[model samples]
Structure formats: structure tokens, C-alpha cells
Target: MIPQNIVKQNILDAIAVIHKEGVPKERESTKYHLWYNGGLYPPKYVISVANRFANGHALSRDRFNGGAETNNFLKRLGFEVIEETLATKNEMQMSEEQTFRVGEYYSRNDIYQKLNVPKAKQKGHWNTGYTQYEKDSFIFANVGTAGRTGHDHPNRFDGNDLIWYGRNKSTLTQSSIQSLINPEGRTYIFAREDSNDPKFLFLGNGRAKDYFDESPVKIIWSFDNETENHPEILAEEVNELEIYTEGSVKKVSVNVYERNPIARKKCIEHYGLGCQVCGFNFVNIYGIIGENFIHVHHLKPLHEISEKYEIDPVEDLRPICPNCHAMLHKRKPAYSIEELKRIIKDKVTDTPH
Candidate 1:
């Protein structure tokens, strides 16, 4: 929201902020401009960005309009408002299609209304709809809360893995649970470390390691550092659709991922259904239910590939157990299979039998 009067210095500061953070892709203008020192800036967007200096934070686009109201306000401040060509708009670099950035914080309303991500209807383990940038969905969790039924499930970390419990009476076969194993899509975490925090931290992406039975489905989620960064361009405010307070929470979720399935199938065909690092065969342990169960790991991770790459099943893929797969990706760049195997070997050799 724009104030009655804003000094000229705030407009200069907003221009500087735009250069540093780049403009939000959707908010960039194609025709209108507010001329300043020979540079053309988007009319309403300038005020939206200028809010940091004028109102202490940026406001969402819906809170104000550009046409006559915003342009006239800036004119009253003695600034030149001019019509510009679409070609002039290309001068600024646009923040690419990215989502809730890792390490940054966001409230529920930012996800639903602002970003247009579908609301996660479930209280704890939620099913949020698809995100626009990628075909995969964006899911979130408000951690550190026990259920209303008096069950204590804080979703604690065991070693590097986190054991997350689904909503009350949830089963291993629920769509949310199935998302972990679904090869077509992967899950990104928007989790608040402390339930009372107003916003959630984008805590990397997660895949399924293992899961157990119902009432509240128990899943061992293995997280990877693979995450996208939403440009730090917007104003930070306490806009919320669902709030997580002490002893109670309103929560949401969505399932999504991106991968090469044909390559994965070929890798399984070559490697067989067993863990390459530890030789843990799913069928050998769990019989029929575990049949064909294994996580196909890319020797070359997706984030590392900048251009289109033809995946080689023999050269770039491997069959790994969920536990070992999690360990492989624990660090940046991920550990090589030989390196992880040696780690297991060294630990076993050091153990007293």
C-alpha cells in the first residue's frame, strides 16, 4: 500500500533494490513506465518495491493498483510518469521461475494467495496442489506440534533422517505417503523448525526412505540439499492463511517431483533390485511387498546439469537402498558410491564384535 506522500530518496532506494534482487518475473511491466533520471521503471511495481523505504516492507500486488491511482500519486511527488515501449522493459534482468528459496522464511498466505500455490487442506500431512514453475507440487509442514489426540509426534531427526508422522489415522498408502515413492515427482519441504515461528524455512527437498502403518503414518524422510531459491525481492510481512500457535496448528501439504523415469527403469534392469552399496535386497527382506523396491540414484545429480543431458543407464545410474541413498546425498555434490561403501566398511571394521 502506498502512503499519502513519499520523499524522492525512497524511490532511488527502490531502484537500487531492484538492481540487486532483480524484479519478480510476473510483476514486470511491458508498456507503462515512470521516467527517472533517463531510466524507465514499472509504475506500480516501483511503489511495490519502494514500500521497503516508505512503509517498512513490500506489499503484494493485490493491495494496490497501477493505472491512474499509483501513477498520479508518484506524479504528485513531482516524478515524471511516461509511456514506454515494450522493448524498454528488457533492460532489467527478470528473476527466473523459482520457488520458496531455501533458508528464506514464508507464511501460509504467501504460499497460497501470493504465489498461487494451492492450499494444503490437511492439518499436518497435507496435499498442496501443483506449483507453476515446475510440474511437481510444493508441500509444506509446520513442525514441532503434537496432535490434538494427545499423541506426541514432534517429527524428530534420527541421525540425518527425519521421522515424520502423517495426519491422524493416515496410512502408508495415502497420496501424501505415496509421494515419497512416486518417481515422477519429488517433495520440497517448507517447514518451521519451531511450531510457533510465524514463517517456515525452506528446509530442502525430501524423498521416501521407509514407512510404517496407520492412525498416523510413520515415514522416514531422507532430505537432500537440492532446492531452488526464490528471489529475495518481496516485502516480508506477517500475512497468513493458516497459523501455527502453541498447542494447535492449521497446516497444509502438496506432492511433486521431476526425474527421468525411463533412465531409472534401465538402471534397475542393469543393476537389479538390490542396494549397490550394502546389497540389501528388498524382496529378500520384506518378500512380495518389497518386490522391485529401490531408489535409482543418478551418478550425475540433476542440479549439477545445466544443459540437456542424455542419461546413460550404465554410466550415470545405480540402484541404491533408501537408507544408503540418503547418506549419499547428505552433503553438497553428494558422496560417490565407492566413498559411501568405504565409509560403511571403515565403520564396520572399527566396531568391536
Candidate 2:
């Protein structure tokens, strides 16, 4: 058996690896296996925090009978061992929610009403349609005609979507004419596929100056348009292109970073650095090295966010330890703090010595 201290370090290292590289695949276990002095350490290891049993080693089976002592040790360190894998359920829910949130899975006929296309203008094969106006800013919807705006017109292709040439002065005035006698220079361009696939794909802010000089206007489609640098242009141009062309219909997944600094700080401030599940305090164990150090977990899985919702950090977040946090996320929806507490109770009851 590995020394208790080394085992503890190994566990901590494994948790860190999970935080950095995500859950390791079954085949990739050796890649993340604990190693010391160039030799394989922790001969019996937990393959995945998300999976309970696949590689033959009992995840909950530990030194103590019924693994109570092991469970207790992990709990004290702020971790829990899960019993099943339910990440798929959570992922399926998230997939549906993401599709709905980004306006991707709407029906073909509803595309016109969903995009707020004018009733009188909905009958024709007009390549461009006007959507809603926000604060007097016009939002234009262009149905990509396989890179064709007019008969034999020059087109700029960017993956599956077409970048119709920019508008100059008189042309700009003509494009802005809605016959409602309301023309706004500030415009937003949203793109939809051809009439065959009428689902809107992109939304972008357009400025007259960018188009006045014939600067290439890439169609706006990705919802992840905001970035630290440029807020208007494609935040991740290449990645967005891939998503727009081929990736969106595939298994698109959101990478949820559980470590929310704002939420973490708020949780720690409200509850202190003590683990809410097992009352473990890192500073009490390791002195200055662990001061003000505690892992904050969202009571609700971060991957389930579908819209802009306010999270009350104190109520929605809690400070736990690495072990407990891992255990919480072991299952798809994650275990509640109260549920983990009950697991500790049951383990204590099972272990007499």
C-alpha cells in the first residue's frame, strides 16, 4: 500500500489533473496515472471521477470495511466517491437547452416569425429580410443564396455562409428603405441559410463606416460574439466558421469551467474557508500554505445554464474541499451537500472501528 501521506498527495494531484485536462478517458488512464521516481505509483487507482466502475478497481472500495474509512478520509479532505455515471443525462439536457438558447433548432416555417420578419414581406424569394428594430437600430436578415445576392452577382464566401459585398452611399440609402419612412444608419446583420434551410445562423453589429470602404463583412452567426478584445467582429473567427459550416449540427458541447472566481470569492466571504460538507479547513491543516484556500462548487451544475440568470453566490454556491467537490461532480447532476453529508453518516454507521 502507498504511504497515507503520498496517497493523499496523489489524490490531490489527480484532482488537479482533472481540473486542468477534464475527465480522463479509460484508455488515457495511464497518461494520468500517479507516478513517482519514473515508476507507476498508486497501483490501484480511481480511473475517473465521473465513472464509478469500468477499469475494475472499486472506486468506493478503500482500506476500511465498506470503504468507510476511505470515504471518511476523502470527506475530511472535502471529496466524495460517487456510485454511478449520469453525465450523459446532464449533457443531453444541456444540449437541448443550448440549441434552444442559441436559436439553432427552430422549425423552418417558424424561422420567419421567430426572426420577426415583416408579415407583408414574408411571401417572396427576396434574398434579404428585415427583422426587429431595437432602440431604433435596424437588424437585417440575409438568406444566404449559395453566395449569390443578385443574378450573376459577385459573392464573398466564408465557409457555408456568404459575405455579400458592403453598401456604398446611395446603395446604403436604398437598402435602408423599409417604406415605413424610418431609416437608421446603425444596423445589425443576422444571417440565415438559403430558403431550403431558413434557420438563422448569425447576428452581428454593423457600422456604416466598415461597409463604406468595401471592407469584407463576414456574416455574423455565432452567439459567442463577445471577447476580451473585439466585441463586434468575430470573437473566434476560425472556430465560429467551423461551427457555422460543419460543427453546429454535430455534437457541440460547452466547456464548463467550474471555478468561478467571482462566485468562489463570494462563497468564501459568506461562509469562510471551512468546508461546508465536512468542516475541513485547509489553513488549519497546512498553515499559511492553505490560508484563504477552499474550493467553491455551484450547487447547480454550471453546464445547465441556458440564459442570462442571476446566481446568488451565497445560496447557490458553497465552499468545500477538493475531494468533496470531486464527489459532488462525480455524477451527472452532482450530489447535494446534504446528500454527501448523508453518505458520511452512512459510512460512519457501517464502520465500527
Candidate 3:
């Protein structure tokens, strides 16, 4: 177990390093600096932070030697660090000219490779492993003028579903669309309203017609064009229909509560099945493992509220191990997430002077 003082000091040191070495690049845009594009903090600062934390550790393998040390140190500090192994410098760069590369998109193979775990080789080709919620979360995080445009493209295996919204759609073409897909796989293309040359195009990852004569191809075109309202009929004239020999179809269902489950799981996973509000790990508090469950409580009751309003789970949920959960409401109303986090931070600071 890491000492509380050590954790606090390390975090402070990391922040200090970030402030000093992580000086914003003069050429880089202010927005990029603010967002910590490519990865959080500058590469130099990240390395500094990692070196400070990993000063004495057997696992200080050189595998993370080239600025990857930050990820390792963050992992040690009980934060989930998702490094984009597949993204190249150019792809991940936050410059205005930066564009999405085929490799930047995460796939099942990418996930397996990153996890360093082997599984049965996937037969089908797919672009991204992100669920609907994950995709929407990404969109929400980068919305409006502040958000960069033209990053929203469908993955391979999606059959002509143009659900994405973006700016400057006129530049898109059949050839331009093909460049988005690599030789290894295909990608889904969502037509935008901004494009004057409106035509339904499904770029890659479709079965051969011999495999299946009739496959359900769902195509959504912009409502801006009343004539293009019938996408299925319009697609037939262009022979945009394609078949998949052995590929999986990606489906996205919109739900009211998107990030709640993810936040809950993350809290449990990060805190090690323990309550952050009160230091109650399952084994430490309860002898029976079965009884040692952590419950996620929403700061604002979600179900009671109507679906018309959008709620952010990050601002709402608190993970309390079963013991803390019971004790929290024993007398007064349950504490808000902010209150709980403050209490936990205080407890950690106050321990042993």
C-alpha cells in the first residue's frame, strides 16, 4: 500500500513538473494547450512526473523509456491510463492541420494488443471498439465552436449509416472517402447536411453478394434534403449495396443515462473495490467477500428526474463500499459527491499529522 503522504507529495510534485517543463509550445494553438492534446500535459513534463514516481521500482523497464513512463506512473497512482499505441505523432497531434489517420482508430486487435493479451483472431474487420456511449461521450466533450470539426467518421463494417454531423461536407467524395480506409479494413461514412453534392457512400467492410442476397442496410441521410429522405431507394440506383462474408455489424442504441455505469465501474475499478468516502475495502471491513459490495449512489437522483434533461454522471455519482454506504445515510441525508470527495481528501490529509 502507498503511504498517504507519499501519494500527496507525488501528486504535488507531478503537478509542479507539469507547470515547469510542460510549457506550452509557442506554435501550438491555445486550445490545444488548454486541452492537453495528443496526451494530457507536455511530453517532457509527463516524463518528468514518471521519473519522479518510478525512482525505485523493479518494473521500471525501458519498455516505457520514451515518454511512456508517465502512463506507468499514473497506473501506479491507481489511475487508468489508456495510451493510444496505434496513433502516430502526426495522427495524435493537435495542430489545426491534424487529421485522423486510419491507424488512430482503435479496433479489437488494437485493444488486444494494448492489453497484451491474446485471444482468438478476429475474422471480421472493424474500425473502433468504442460503444455508443463512449462515442457520444467523446462528442459531448468536444462540442460547439470550441470542438474541432471533421473528426466524426463511421468505422468499417457499418453499412451506410450517416448519423454523424460535421462541418464542410462539400469536399467529401468517393475517392476522398476511400483514402480513409486502410488496405486491412473498411470504414463507415455518414453524409452531412453541409455537403451540396449529396450522395450515399458506404466505403468499406461489406460482405460479397454471394454470401447473402438480402442484408438489412440502414442508411440515414440529412433531413436538409427532402429528396434524399429515402436513402434506401437512393442507394439502390448507385449500387452502393455491398455484402459481408464474415463480419460483425456495429449497433448503437441511445440511452438516457450514458456515463453512469461507466463512472460507477471506473470508481470501483480505480479505488480497488474500496470506498473512497471511508477507507472500507471489502476484506478489511467484512470477513465475507460476498457481503463486501460497493454501491454507487447518485448525488442527484436520476430515475426521479425526466429524460428531457441531460445529466453528467461525473458530477453526480459517489462510490461507497457497502459499509460506508449504510453509514452515510444512517442519520442525515446522503452526502453529495463533492462533499464526499472533500471529506475523503481531508481524511487523507489529516492522518498522522
Candidate 4:
């Protein structure tokens, strides 16, 4: 029996503790989760962590039984345990046997076996980009970041947008493309921090926002559901200071750190897409193609900082156009928002001293 001393706050603290240490992928639940604060968490792990608050040490997994005992206990405390994720827009819902959590990570094979996807309808080979699990009316696009899989049909994320390209040497009429366009079905795209990572984040249920080109069709997917961050996936920036050996290459190595999209969105939401310094708005100039196309500038340079610190998007970052963003970085330590504003004002008025 759980100690009566253990309360709801203890469970919340446990989640924070686990998040800081990195949630163990192996311990994540495939079916059951305690849905709290709009995030899905493994119930057993929650119990284990919550015990640390009630007692000095974590309760051994052997001491407790799962399923009814755990579920009932959480229920008694006003916490709800559901199978995978909650549904929306309609009465649609995936069962305990097939549903997956949005932020949860799973390998390609694991997802296939868990959902019992049919062998006949599997999209194609692993390198074929998308796997169509028609049995569940879903298509999973296993995408690659920029150069990791080469320039050919690379699926990259632009802030909240996912820029994905269909398989090369294919047409828009293909089954996979049809599945994407079909309003009757759904699509889920997954990607990892690096090539070595085995599991991909179930990004979210994506709706087709825009599409263009052919042969290898380019599509933009927008997610209405919640999104999470992979810290290693940094934004696109030129490295001007790194040493280079252009010709003869030995063993190749690379390291990447991704800007938090959630943070970027928060900054944009607070400041809008208008450039803070020069007042240029991409959407106003470029139509639908340039919507949500403002560069974000950090008040403190990311490269100069060596420690981990919490970022307050509204306070620490601002939206700027590419031209203004580049000008702000023309000097070391970058220019202040006020300084750049003053410069722009002076230039516009032709009052430079």
C-alpha cells in the first residue's frame, strides 16, 4: 500500500526530477500512463519516484504490483490513468493495444510490432522514407535531418513546421502521397537528434499546410498538437570561427545542438513575426510562403555561454529579420536591441554624426 503521506505534489516533483536526469526510454510505458498537466507519463515510474518523496529511498519495483493496484491507487488520489493519448476533434481514439503517446519515443520496429501493422501494407524498405501502416489509417514518415541523409529529400524542421520531401523518383499520385493528402486519414512524422539514436519522437499528428514541386514532392506539415524539444537539434547558423581542412578528409565527426522550438514559438507569440529592430515583417512582404519566417536572436550569445540556464523567451529573445539579425552580429558579443534600434532610426532620418 502507498503511504498516505504521498500526495499529488510529490508525483509532480518526481516528474521534474526525471526530466532533468533524462527520462529513461526503457522504462516508458507502451500502454498505461498517468495523464497530468497535458503530458503523458509512465505510471509505474511515477509511483517509484513518488516513493522517494514519501520515503528517503525509492520503492523497489518488486514491492508493488502493476495494472489494477497501481491504476486504482492513482485513481484514489484523483489522478487519471489512460491508455496512450487522448483523442480530439471527434470521438476518435486509439485503443490500449495500438495508441502511442505524442512525446513518447519508440523505434520503427517497436512501433510496428506494438500496433500489429500488417506485413503486406508496410510502405517499403527502411531507406524508402515513409512506412504506410494502412491497417490503422496512418502513415509514419521516418525523416532525416539536413545533411545526415544527404540533400536528396531531406526532411527538416523549420520552427513549428516540418519541411518533408517525398521519396525521390516518385510522383504525387503514389500511395504514400495519397495517404498524406487524404483528409479521411492521418500522418505522423518522426525524427531523432542524431543518426545513432534508435528511437524517434512521435512529433505529432500533422495536417498538410502547403505543398509544391514534383518528382520528389515537397510538403510542409503543421502540427496543432503539443510539441517537445530535442536539445541537440540546433538552428541553422554559419560557423565562421571553426578551423577547416578543406581537401583531404580523415575520419568525419559532427556535433549539433538544436534551438528549442517551443522557446522560439513563445518569443514569436509574445513579439509577433515583425522584426524588433527594423520593423520588417516577412509575411507582409512575401505572402503565405513567408508566414512565420522571422529569425530569433538571443540576447546572450549561445556559443559564449558554457552552462545550462533556463531561457525566458519573451525576456531573453526577440524576433528579427535575417538582415537585422546579421547586422546585430557584425561585432563580438552582438549589438543590443536598443543600439540596433537607434542605429536604424538614425539611418532612416539621415542624422548620422
Candidate 5:
């Protein structure tokens, strides 16, 4: 039997190793196998890392074969267990179970690679969102720093925006833009730090509404708050909530939003296909091809509201394009549609064109 203190120390030490090396892949150097709570399993048809605890000294090839005990332990810990098949050369295959299961906890790039979503047609870029629908509706994002690699200095929430970064130097093509702004997509964010035991803390989910080029090379995908209440998720001070063991797992919860699809639909229906602030309509300009396309923005920011409140489709929601929606959220309290329209008018009049 392992002492509680020894188990705690080993778990912390293992997390430190994973923080540096990431979850171990099959047949890669096994030095980082310390991160797996149970004795590490051999490379098999599917690779998995369970959160089952064991004595650090006994993690060897012989004791590594996982069984009923390990499965039971994982169930009790509430860890979302996943087993993914190796992606073969020339063809990638993944079951639907893998897709829905992944978004519960993985980052964008991580889910793309794990679920074997169809790759980008061009080299040097990858399709981060899926064309296929899942039983569950969600995507995962790592908020903090440029690449989830440091302090919370550049949090998207701080900028009053939900941001997704693109591959550096990759040309932003029309296809890339569609993959990001497709109205069907929704995202679940995770609070990740440079050093954390589990590495991901569940935040909440929302819809991807717009995209912009921060630079010629950098693409920013912006999302709107649909039904997410993210105050607790965003308020967490880095490393303050310890998830060192199963008992401490209450720090994270499986938060799923009760999104008002009816309200979203009605807002677009009433406002037509044009952005309320900028007056940009996908359909009128792009012909029949862009019909029925507009993002619905919630007037009140979810973080500010703590209790359940009824949504008024006309008063609480507005149909806006991605650009207008992103601008509306640029300030802390967020600019009203009238204010944003006024700002746009000023910019347009000031320009020589």
C-alpha cells in the first residue's frame, strides 16, 4: 500500500514532468511515463493515460498492464477517459465517439489531431474545426498567453474578446475563413497554465462568430457568448485551485450551457441578414450564396450576470456580422450597438475612400 503523502508527492512530481513533455505518445521515449497515475501501459492499438494512482517506485513494464482496478479508479476520479487509435500514413481514421469525447477537455489543435478531422487541402495549414456534426456541440480553447505557455498577461477575456490564434505565417485563404466563422461551430474554453497538474480546467462554451487578420500572418477567430456563465471559470487565480488528487477534483466541473437557440434564431430572423451596427449583410452582397448568415450577439455579457435571467430576443439579442460583433465587445462593459454604429460612421467619414 502507498502512503498518502508519497502518493501526493509522486503525483506532483509526475505533473511537473508532463508539464514539460506533454502526455506521452506511444513508442516515444518512455521517460515521461511518470505522469500516468497508474503503472504505464505498453504501446498498444490505442494509447491512453489513466489517472489511477500507484507507487512511483513500482511503475515498470510488468506492473503496467491496466485492468479492472485501474478502470474503477478512473471512474471514481471523474476523469474523462479516452482511447484513440494511431493515425496511419496517408489515411486518418477516427470514430464519432472520439470526436464528441475530445472537446470535453482538449485544446483546438489537440482535438484536430486527436479526432483525425479532414486536414487542410493546402500544406503548412490545418483545418482546426470539423465539417461533421457531433452528438454533443462543443470545442475546446486554452486561454492565457499566446500559446498557453505563460502568465495570464494576454487573456482574451482581458481584451474583452474570445480569441483563437492561427498558424504563424500561414496565408489566410477563403477556406480558412469559412472553417473558423461557420455559424454551426461552438467552443468550450479551458483555463490552462504553464504549470498545472491536470493541465486543463473546464471554463465554458460559446459560438465562433467572426475572424480577423491581426497581421498578414496571424488569424484571430472571435466567438460570442451565447449561454455561457464564465465568471467562476475566469475568476480563478492561476494555480490557486489545486487538482492534486481525486478529492480535490471539485475545483473543476462539467459545465454545459443551456443555450437559447430559439432566441438566436429569432434575432437573426427579425434583423434580416445584415449586421445591425455595420449594416453588412452576407446575402444581399454575396447573392443567394450567403443567404441566412448572420451572427447573433447577446447584449449583456455572461460574466456580469450571476443569476438566471430571461432572454428577450428583441431587446437582449441582435443580429450582427463578425466584425461588428467583435467591436461591440472591445470594451469592458461593451459598447452598445448605437455607440458602435456611431464609431463606424466616424471611421468611414474620416477615411479618404
Candidate 6:
């Protein structure tokens, strides 16, 4: 069976890729800003490079311009390319499985090249959001800083975001694993091995620990263990001993660390404690009382429980002001702040008055 820790770590890794390389942002209404320093290039060039380095097949002009050229460049650097289009009547559909496969392919190959870097004297810090135990226990086995090295550095752009490169795997105690699985009474997305389907499994829950003997998850870092800096993966070896029937592995609630107090404070500092949803500037409204105000909210919900029962803070909390918080839970079943904003916007746009 695919280990639970590996599944969660992979999901986090995938999310990071999506956030960094999914697409470009626009300024005002006119200028388009690509994530990399390079501005816009032709579609063909981009596609070509992507195809070469990371086996990316579908290159959409509307979504990704210059995809062809990108694929070609990657090929020159030594990477596989896979291109296949679905036969949808109107919109072209690409499977998440395929997208994730491309990401995994690039990540694995990148690790191969990163293994060449000289080991660092001190290990990098681990940010588990609780005690420093997890960070201290980290041992970089192989791999180097994700981007700054080798033939493994594939130019795989999800949209305009840079997909970092490197790999490292490590083990975490069951206690630590519990904290990660269901931090602060919420669940997060994770990956696991499907007993029925050996391909892969995507799950969101706390039951992931049952797959392991001692440690809950085996993390594979993309950077060298000696250096200790960089993201790591939680993985397990797939062998005959782990095989099981379908439904034997089930999804349960678990906590995840996406945002914490420090992160929330940073966002408030950047946005000046204003409600991004309603444009309510706290300072202007409440004066001095609102000085260090504003609450942070998580875009995703975390699971409240796990198999082992662990309590974590970082994975389940977000900051937000009371007004916004109330608004979030105002309706029956509640609505996300973003969802509320969209609903309000639509209502106004359609109003005759």
C-alpha cells in the first residue's frame, strides 16, 4: 500500500507546483506578468521546451503561450515529452492524473541531478509550526537546492510559475505524523497508494498512519540531507508485503499546516488589515482599536481528527476580523469569504437599480 505520509507530502508538493507555475497574473486590466523574469515569448518555443524537459503533451495557446518552444528546450536538456488531447466536443479536457504524472516525472529526474551537490555542514531548518523536534531530526540524505543546479533542472512551467527541482525522503515519528495529519482539527489533501489501483491514491484524512510501523510518514526531501534545507517528500517503498484489497485503505479526517499565526500576521502587514472581500479597511473604521487587527482565514478546511489523535495549531488556523468571520459563517452551511464576495458581485451586476 502507498504510505499515508507520502501521499500527504506529494499532495503538498503538487499544490506548491500549481501555485508557482499554474499561470501568469495581470496588473490592473492590461499588462500580463509572467512569474519568471522573462516576459512573453512565442507559444511554440514554450511548448517545445516543456515537452523536452518534462513530458508535457498538451500545449494550449489560450492558457500557455510559447509552450512548444518551452518543450523543445527541455528536450535538449534531456527529459521525456508526452502529448495527447482528449476528444471533448467543446472544451479540451486534461486529466489531473496526467498533470500530476508530469510533475512527478520532472521531480524525480531533477532529484537525480541535484544529488551531485557538495553536502552542507549544517542541515537546513524544518518548519513544522510546533516544536523544533521535527526540524532537528531532519537528515538530508541526497539532493541539493531545488533550482540552482544540474541537467535535472527541467523548465516545467504550470502556467508561468516555476516548478522547483530536487528530492529527499525521511521518516517522521507517529506523534509528529499525527500533528501533520490533523493539525488544529482540520484535514488537508494527501496522497496514498491504492490497493486496487497500484497507480496512485489521493486522500484527505487521518487514517494515513496505519500504513506505517513506527513513523507515520517517510519524507523524501528534494535537497541533500547533509544540507538539511529544502522541502522533503514523505514516501515508502512499494513491495509485495504491502498489497491489500480495495476499501482496506480508507480516507479519514486529518489536520494540515498551510497557514499559521506568523503567516497570517505577514498577510495582514502586507494588506494593512483590510477585508479583501468587502474592502473594509479596519484602520479607517475602528481607528486605534483596529491597529493590530484583522483575522486570517484558510481557503481550505482541515480535518478535526486522525487515527492516532494529534492536536496541531498551524494546520488548522487562519486570521480574520470578527465581522468577516461572522460573515463567513452567516449563512446556513456557511460560505467562504471568497464565495460570499462572488455571490454579492453577481447580485449587484444583475440588479436593475
lDDT of 2 by residue, 51-112 (tens): 22222233432432323443444545544332212542343234333312221233334545
Model 1 ranges with Cα > 4 A deviation: 1-95, 114-139, 147-151, 194-196, 225-353
- Residue 127 lDDT, candidate 1, scale 0-100: 30
lDDT winner, 4 or 5: 4
Candidate 6 RMSD to the real structure: 21.4
- Per residue, candidate 1 scores C-alpha lDDT tens digits across 1-353 of 56755567888888777766767778776656665532456778888778778778876778887788887888787666655434233322221233544444566665555456444442232333112223354545544454334545656545335567766666767665565556455466565444455566555466677877756777776654322322111112122212334444533211011123334445666777678999897544542224345766778766766654545667888888878977988887889999999999999999999
lDDT of 6 by residue, 197-299 (tens): 2121111122223223332233221111211111111112121124344335533211133222223333444554456677664434432223334555555
lDDT of each: 0.58, 0.44, 0.34, 0.62, 0.42, 0.32
**C-alpha displacement of 101 in model 5, angstroms?**
27
Could you tell me how far off, in angstroms, the CA of residue 118 lies in candidate 4 after the best superposition? Answer: 4.6
TM-score of each: 0.36, 0.29, 0.28, 0.42, 0.28, 0.24
TM-score of 1: 0.36
The TM-score, computed over Cα atoms with residue i paired to residue i, of candidate 4 is 0.42
Estimate, for each residue in 1-353, the C-alpha lDDT of model 4 and write its tens digit.
Answer: 66668788888888778756755787777666665533557788888898998787887777887788887888787666665323311112221222564545668776767767676644355445565554323433443433235543556666556777776666677766767766554576665545556676666667788887577888888665323222222233122113234443333212111234545656776887678998887544543224346777888766756755556778888888878878988887788989988998878799655
Task: Return whichever of 1 and 6 wins on lDDT.
Answer: 1
lDDT of 3 by residue, 237-272 (tens): 232222222353433322223213233333444445
Cα misplacement distance, residue 153 of candidate 1 (Å): 1.3
Q: Candidate 1, overall lDDT?
A: 0.58
Choose the strongest candidate by TM-score.
Answer: 4
**Poorest 10 consecutive residues of model 5 by lDDT?**
88-97
RMSD of each: 21.5, 20.9, 17.6, 16.2, 22.3, 21.4
